[model samples]
Target: MESNKSGFEPKNIWIARRKKQLRSAIIDLLNQYHEVPKEWIDEYNNHTIMSGSIIDTIIIIKESSTNCYEVQFGNGKSGSIVYSELDYEFQLFEATSEVEQVILCRNKVGLTKDKSFVQTMIDWLTSIGFIVDVDNGLRQTT
Candidate 1:
């Protein structure tokens, strides 16, 4: 017989006051910059690639709202709706990949694919005065 064992230790490297200062600084930085990274916009502009529009695919975390908003997954590049073997919508993998690359291009971009990421994003957005409804993911996704 064997018993499960766990080893974990919490470490505090910074003083509470110093941590507060650093946290304030980060929040200030985030609040000041409220635009999608220009690198993505510029790159998208330079490339004439198509199949879907950014409006339909990009998960724009707009100001005052915290929803990873995106349109319904329908209509393939070939103008057909696809479904998985289990009767779920089969997202256009290639197109969705492109969208993810451009919108979630940055390390901070959280998405539905990762719940932790989405919750982290919600917290950050909330701190920045955005109304995040994480529970409404289905509504937002659709």
Candidate 2:
């Protein structure tokens, strides 16, 4: 689905600025890690999120110095990649709310891929005082 970063008031501005900030920060990181391989971007990232009918987008994990998160995938195996290391593949999804980005990673995790990730995301967002809906990809609520 197309992303919805727009909203009333200064929110749309804030989201736009945040997205720029993150992209800049990640670019700086990439400059520092110049030798990072294409494999990490292609092989590791382009993998399908799940094996079967419930499959969704091809997924990648990303982190930044400001954000480090992990997700469970395949028989409890978990992996994380620095957000800056995401390459061009993740730019679209990662540009959304950071919380949503992490939830996407979480959804891609684990063989079962159930609602627990959604539950966890709802808890996290609510804890931070952001009324968000996980099923809606953490879109802020009115």
Candidate 3:
């Protein structure tokens, strides 16, 4: 996702350029202090298992050297990535304590963009003791 420094309009979804820069910086910070890996999986059958499963296209970052984070992106509406022989919906479902943050990103053009979805996702993250926020920038959340 991409956005400009002027901030996104009510009709845009991609990460604003400024937000993207902040996210990259946060990722870099996490990498500097912990093992930051993307798209990891168990070795058994190469199943795409990260922290937990949410839905058909969302995967929660529940397991990592740093902490827990639910990084949601892509939609089953499009050609969403799939994993596991069981064919589980790959959404970030698990609200684990190990996760400290939740990062959600989407194309912004095709998603529901409903605050309910975002709030629900945030509720889930906060319920499990994690800092939750849209991946607009690296603003810390309690």
CA RMSD of all predictions: 16.9, 19.8, 18.4
What would the per-residue lDDT of candidate 1 be over residues 31-59, giving only the tens digit for each residue?
Answer: 45333343433333223133133322123
lDDT of 3 by residue, 16-39 (tens): 343344435534544343332332
> How far off is model 1, as Cα RMSD?
16.9
**For residues 15-96, what per-residue lDDT tens digits would candidate 2 score against the true structure?**
5565445434433434353323334323222232222222221222332333333332322233333233334111112323
Clashing residue pairs, candidate 2? 63-82, 63-83, 72-110, 73-110
Candidate 1 runs further than 4 Å off: 1-14, 34-124, 127-142
Clashing pairs in 1: none
Each prediction's whole-model lDDT (CA): 0.32, 0.32, 0.32
